[model samples]
Target: RVMYTITKWIEHKLGLKVNATKTHITRPNKLKYLGFGFYYDTKDKKYCARPHASSIQRFKRKLKQLTIRKNTMALNERIRQLNQVIRGWINYYSICNMKTHMMNIDKHLRTRLRVIIWKQWKVPSKR
Candidate 1:
C-alpha cells in the first residue's frame, strides 16, 4: 500500500531504515506515542489523549522510590523533594485531560506520604 511504498522510498532513496517492530498501521485510537495513549471518545465523537498505563506505572515506581522510609530524610525535606518531582510531572502531562486518573494518583500519593509519616513517628501514641 501507500505506507509500504513510502517506507521503501525512505529506505532505498533516503538511506534511512524503519524499525518494523515499533511501527503501527492501525487507527490513532490504538496507537500510543510519547507516553500518551489516543482513543476515540464516543460521547464527544472525537479523539482524546491520556497517559498510557505503562507511563503511569513508571511514575508510580519513581514516586515509591522517593517515598521509601529508609531514606531517613526530614519530613519537610521529603515533602519538598516530592513536590518538586510531582510538579514537573504534572506540568509535562498537563495537556492530557486525565483528571480522574490524576485524582487517583494524588490519593495514592497521600496514602504513601501518610505511611512514611507513621513510620517516622514509630508509635500509635505519637501518631
Candidate 2:
C-alpha cells in the first residue's frame, strides 16, 4: 500500500525600472505661471499647497553626509602620498645637494621646487 499527499504551488513576480534623472519630487506650491500669477482661486476654493515628504528630507540629509565622507577620504589619500614624496626629497638633498652645494646653483630653484611641491600636494598656503 502507498500513501498520497497533495501540495499547492504559488508564483509571484514584480518589475521595477529606475530612472535616476527624473526621480526628483516637485511640490505644488513651487509651480507658477506668469499671467496666472501663483495660482487661481474659485470662491474659497484654490489650487493649494502641500509640503515635501519627511522621507525626501531625510534622504537629502544622508546624501550630503555621504558626499562629505567621500571627499575627505580622497583628500586624505593625496596627503599621504605627498608626505612620502617630501621624505624622499629630503634624503636626496642630504646625500647629493649638500655635497654639491655651489654658489652658482640658483636660489630661485629652491623656491620653485617648494611651490611645485605645494601645488602638487594641494596644500593651502606656501608659508
Candidate 3:
C-alpha cells in the first residue's frame, strides 16, 4: 500500500513517472546503491557496506586499460597515472567495510604491475 501511494505521489504530485520494471521493494540490506551493496554482518552484528561485484569488475576493467602492455607511456608516468586513479577510487570506496576485498584487489594490482614490468623487460638478460 505504501509503495503504491509513493508511486502515485511520484507520478501525480512530483510530475515524474516511475518505471515499474525498475522498481524494487526490499530491505536496505538487500539493495545495491551507487555501486555499493549493503548487508547485515552476523559476526559484527551490524549493517555494513561493500562494493558490489559488478562495481569491482568495472574498476578492474578500468585498471586493465590503464595498465595495458602497449601503452608506450614511461613506467614512472604510468605509475603516477595509476596512483591518481587508485587514490580517487579508494577514497570513494573506503567508506565500505571491505578489507578482504581491498586486499585481494591490491594483490591483483601488484600482479598486473609485475606483468607490465616483465613485458617492458623484453630482453631475457633484463629479467
Candidate 4:
C-alpha cells in the first residue's frame, strides 16, 4: 500500500514516473544509503548509521593499490600516500559509529606496511 501510494504520488504530484524494476520495500539496514548503513542502537536507545561494508572494501582496495609489494617508490612516499588516503577516508567516516572496524583496519594497514618494509630490506639478516 505504501509503495503504491508513493508511486502514484510520484507519477501525479511530482510528474515523475517510478521505475518499478528499481524499487523495492526493505529495511534500511539492508540497503546502503550514500555509503552508509542504518541500524537501531540498543544502548543509545535510537537509530544510527555507519560506513557500509562496500565502502570499507573500496577503502581496502585503494590501500592495496598504494601498498603493492612491487611498487618501487620509496617507503616514505608510500607512507605519505597512505596517510593521505587514511586521513581523507577517516574524515569522511568520522560521523559514523565504527570504532572497532576502524581499529581492525588500522591493524591490517600496519601489517601491510611492515610487509612492504620487510620486502624492501631483501636480506633476512638485514630484515
Which one is best on TM-score?
4
For model 1, what is the C-alpha lDDT against the true structure?
Answer: 0.86
What global local distance difference test value does model 4 have? Answer: 0.89
TM-score of each model, paired residue for residue: 0.81, 0.19, 0.80, 0.83
Query: 85-113, model 1: which lDDT tens digit per residue?
Result: 88988888888878988899899989989
Q: Considering lDDT, which of the candidate structures 2 and 3 is the better prediction for this target?
A: 3
Local accuracy of candidate 2 as per-residue lDDT tens digits, 1-127: 1111111111112233434454333444554322111233466576632212342244335433433422444545644554565455345333222212222222533444455455556756634
lDDT of model number 2: 0.37
Q: Give per-model CA RMSD.
A: 2.8, 25.1, 2.7, 2.4
Error of 1 at 37 (Å): 0.5
- Displacement of the residue 124 alpha carbon in candidate 4, Å: 9.3
lDDT of each: 0.86, 0.37, 0.88, 0.89
List runs of model 4 lying over 4 Å from the truth: 14-17, 123-127
Itemize residue pairs with steric clashes in candidate 3. Answer: none
Report the error of model 2 at residue 1, Å: 99
The digit string of per-residue lDDT tens for model 3 on 11-73 reads 999999899888978987778889898889899998888988888889888889988988888
**lDDT, candidate 3, residue 31?**
86
- For residue 57, what is the lDDT in candidate 1? 90
Model 1: what TM-score?
A: 0.81
Task: List, residue by residue over 20-104, the lDDT tens digit for candidate 4.
Answer: 9878889887888789988888898777989999999999999999989989999889989989998999899888998988889
